[model samples]
Structures are given as structure tokens and as C-alpha cells.
Target: MDAIFNYLDNMFAHLPKTEEVVRAKNELGQMMEDKYNQLRAEGCSDNEAVGQVISEFGNLSELAEELGISNQYQSASSEDKFVSVTAAEGEAFIEKTKKAANKIGTGIAAILLGVISIIFFSGYAEGTFSPTLGGGEPNKIYIAVGLGLLFILVAFAVYLFVMTGITTEKYEIFEKKMVKLDPHYKLIIQEAKENHRPVLTRKISIGVGLILLAVAALAVSGILSEDNEALLISLVCVLLATVGVSVWLFLSGGMIQSAYDKLLNEGDYTLERRKSESVVQRWASPYWSLVVVVYLAWSFITADWSKSWIIWPISGVSFGLISTIIHAATSSKQ
Candidate 1:
């Protein structure tokens, strides 16, 4: 029986795992096992029974018609160019994407935290920089330290973003090209995404709630007197912190969902969208690179860090419009 099973395994080892091939393998495996058992029961030795089964079973090519995988067995591996993924690899990719999403979300949140630290440190230091409280040195020391930490945190965040991309580079094929998912793994992948959907909704809801809470804080702050500088700054910092947390929650949920989309070729990663986005992708890399250059150049040249950050928010909003217009134009042309 073991020998018969081993022989069956070797026979199908190189075959493309089309649905027909998989079904054929199972049906043939059962037949082979039954035949081997019948021979053994008839007083034949193990080796003789295994030999008889192998001889009778012949090869996959000969039995292709009976198994209904004749065409698939002959041409699938040669003609099909779509990528295939193993169940183990698919699960591992999902887990890896979750970790990357968490890391990226945390990094984005850290940038906001860094901004809060800068404002808080400078505000606190400047207020107490008098001769009686501390000295004039507190202002310089506080601003310098705050700025230093901000740059360091930003650098670390960028490093994480880059590393995640590099580590997952091999899986880019799923995004760049169509994937012919093995029938055996489709149910597994669908089950995983379905299970993860509820959690995704919860995370997104929590994120929206947090953003609303941040907005309410600003309203409360605005209602109070403008004379209280410390109180105003404190409320503003709280708002930033709240929004950072919301962004983290949103990205964490979105990233995992994006992983499922890539596997299923649905949502933003659909085959049609992927084909259309090839044009947008070409524009995106340089557009962002130019934005970064402009941001840094304008910030340093004007010596106005506060207003310079507004470029990010504006660019972000405008890019959505730009991409949408591009998508519509390309889609309409087709």
C-alpha cells in the first residue's frame, strides 16, 4: 500500500494542480489503494501486490482519458502563465502582511507623536525660559532636542516602509499579474478572508470613532477662551494624538484587507483595475518623489517648518483627485 501510494505521488508530482488533475489524483489514488489491498488479501506478498497495482495502474498519460484530465495534464503547465500559490505560502503571506501593516501603522502614528513632542517640548521650554525659572538655554535645548528626535523618528519610519517593500518584493507578481489560484486553496483563502472581515469592520469603526472624538475635542477647545495658550496647545496635542491612533487603526485594518484582495483579485486589486493602474503606477513614483523634493526644499528654503507640513495634507487630498481623473480617463478610452 505504501509503495503504491508513493508511486501515485511520483506520478502526479510535476502535474499542474488544476481541478481536474486534483480530482483525478484522488480518484486514481483510491482505485490504486483498493486494487493493492485486494491483491494482498488474495495471499500475494506486499512487494508482489504493489508491483501488480503499479502494472495495472500504468501511468497518468495512459489513464488521462478515464480521469478526465487529458487536456489539462498535457497543456496546463505549458500554456498557463498565471502565477500559482501554495496554501502554506498564502497563509504565510497573510501573516507577513499583517505584521507589516502593524509596523507601518505604528510608524505613521510615531510621526504624529514626534510632531506632538516637538510642539510640547518647545512650548514648555519657551514658557519657562526666563532667568528665574530656568534660563534662555532651555528654549534652544528643547527645540534642538525635539527636532533631533523628530528627524530620527521619521528616518526610522521610512526605513520600515522601505524594508517592508523589499521583503515582500517576490510576492509582487500577484499584484502585477493575474493569479490562477489552485482550486484546493480557494476555499481556504476565502475562509480566512471571511473570518478576518468582522475584525476589519470593527477596526475601521473604531478608527472613525476616534477621529470624531478628536474633532469634538477641537470644538471644546474652540469654545474656551483663546487667552489660555497652554490649554489650547494641550488640547491641540491631544487632538493630534487621537488622530494618530485613528490612522493606525485604519491602516492596520486596510492592509490586511488589501492582502485578501490581492489573493482574490477583488476590490482595488481586481484584474481590470490592475491593468488600468499600470498607467497610474508610472505616474505615482515620480509624483511622490517630486512632492518629497518640493516639501524639503520649501521647508528649508523658507525656514518655515509649521506651514511646510501642510503640503502633505494638500498633496494627499489632491492625489486622490488626480488618480481618480486618470482612472476615469483611461477606463473611458477603453
Candidate 2:
């Protein structure tokens, strides 16, 4: 009986707080008690009855599934019969919800502040402010707005990092409990987590690339227009494209690649065969190598040595070098 109680406690430790899970555990306890009484009636020893009950209880996965905790967003309800268990679960549940809300609030505040700063500074810099408010060149106001936006973006990222830790801890606890319920699911989850990286990378890269192409097109078109308004629109379009590229690299592409590369140490497996990697897979090494050579050659030919500004060619050279390395390494490995 003590052994059974210990096992139950261990199982609950992995589960999130939910009414359905509590009810399931309570049901298991009752079933065990009934089984123990029946064994005693049949002249079985206390230890023997306890062992029988443990063996008969079966895997916890079905119970876990019934409780509807497959994802973080779902919650389960319990009746008055499990009030005590619900109280314990409630605290953890409340904590998770509060953390999520705080994260969202911080993100919203950052975005709103950034947009408002831009609008205010844009209007003021363009000399559109009313008599009471100070006015200046649009450029000066825009520069100030940019600084404020940058600060907000940095703060928002820090808040997100902290929130990530809390959610991940909750997920770890929930996963551990689920393992006792059904061991087979652990393998499924492990595989999914591993494969998610490549898929995420491919999808995000393709999406960002498309967006950049669109924004660049809009910028170029506007730049060619006769209207002065077109110049402002073109500048905005270029700014948007630059921001998109930075976000794609920082948030999506780099993170996904890091995860994929980490798993490379596990076995002889390479990330080349992942589902979203088909585009990269299809491109022959020779073709990519040629691309790198062409870009590198073009960058040097187009360099303007007179002006100290060297961002464009420098970026091009870096891309070419990295692409060349990936191509060469992958080719030899294949």
C-alpha cells in the first residue's frame, strides 16, 4: 500500500494542475484500494495485495490523455470530490497564467511605445506639430524615435527571455509526469522536437526572403517615382526590408540552425535530410560554389574605394564566404 502511494506521488509530480488529472488519480487510488480489499478477503498477505494492485493499474498515458493536457493552452475541470487536489493544482496553474500575461503585456507595451514614438517624432520632425508642441526637421525627430524604438525592442527581448524560462520549466514538469503515464510518447516527442528545427528554419527563411523581396521592390519602385512623397515612402520601405532581414536572421534562421547543429553531435546524422531542407538539398554544390565565386568577384569589382562606407560589399563577401563553406563541407560529407 505504501509503495502504491509512493508511485502515485511520483506520477503526479510530472503532471500540470488540472481537474481531469486529479480525478484520474483519485480514481486510480480508489481502484487500488478496492483491489487490496478483495485480495485480503481472498486470504492474501498485505504485501501481496499491494503488489497485485500495482501490477493491475496499468500505464498512466490513457489517464493523462483523458485529462486533456496534450498542450499548454488546454485546461481541465474537476468536481467537488477532488477539491483538495484542485487546490494544489490551482497554484501552479495560476502561476503559469500570470507569467504568460506578464510576457504579453510587456511585448504589447514595447510595440505600442515604439509605434507612438515613431508617429510623434515623424509628425514633429516633418513640422506637422501644432503651435504648442516643438517642431524640427523630420530627420531629427526620426532619429530620436529610432533610439526610443531600439530601447523598447531590447527591453521586450529581455522580458521574453525571462518568460521563456518559466514556461519551459512548467513544460519539463508536465513532460516528466506524462512519461510515467505512457513511456512510448517520450520517443515520439523527442523525434518531433528534433525535426522541428529544420522545418522551422526552412519555413521562416522562405517567408522572410519573400517579404524582403517584396519590400525591396516597393522601395526601388518608389525611389524611381517623380513625387517627393515617393522618396519618403521608399525610405520607409527600405527600413522595413532591413528590419525584416535582421529579425529573420536573429529570431528564426539562426535559432533554428543552432538547434539543428546541436543535434548533429548526437549521431552520424546530418540535418540535410530534414523535411524543410529539400530546397538546400536540391541545389547542387557546384551551382552554389559558382554563386559564391560570382558574388565575391562582383563585390570587389563594384567596390567604391573613395568613400569609407563599405557595408554593401562587406555583407556580400561575408555571405559568399559562409555559403562556400557550407557547400564544400556538405559536399565532401555526402
Candidate models: Cα lDDT each: 0.75, 0.50
Query: Candidate 2, TM-score vs. the true structure?
Result: 0.33
lDDT of 2 at 72: 26
Residue-wise C-alpha lDDT for candidate 2, range 1-334, written one tens digit per residue: 6766766776677687678888888888888888888999999997677667766777665555577765522332221111121323433543454455445545544543443345344444553444444454446756476546746775775678577666746433321121121222222323445676676667666766765775676567666763544244334434444444444444444433433232221211233333223333355455546654664355336521111113333554665566566656766677
TM-score of each: 0.69, 0.33
Q: Please report the candidate that would top lDDT against the real structure.
A: 1
Query: What would the per-residue lDDT of candidate 1 be over residues 1-334, giving only the tens digit for each residue?
Result: 7666766776687677878778888998998788878988999998678767776775466767865667765674465535778778888888888888888887887877776766666666666223354447646777688778878888888888888888787788877766656543554566678898999899889988986887687677778765666676677677778878877888888888888888877787765688677878898999999998998688667744434656766888888899899888877887
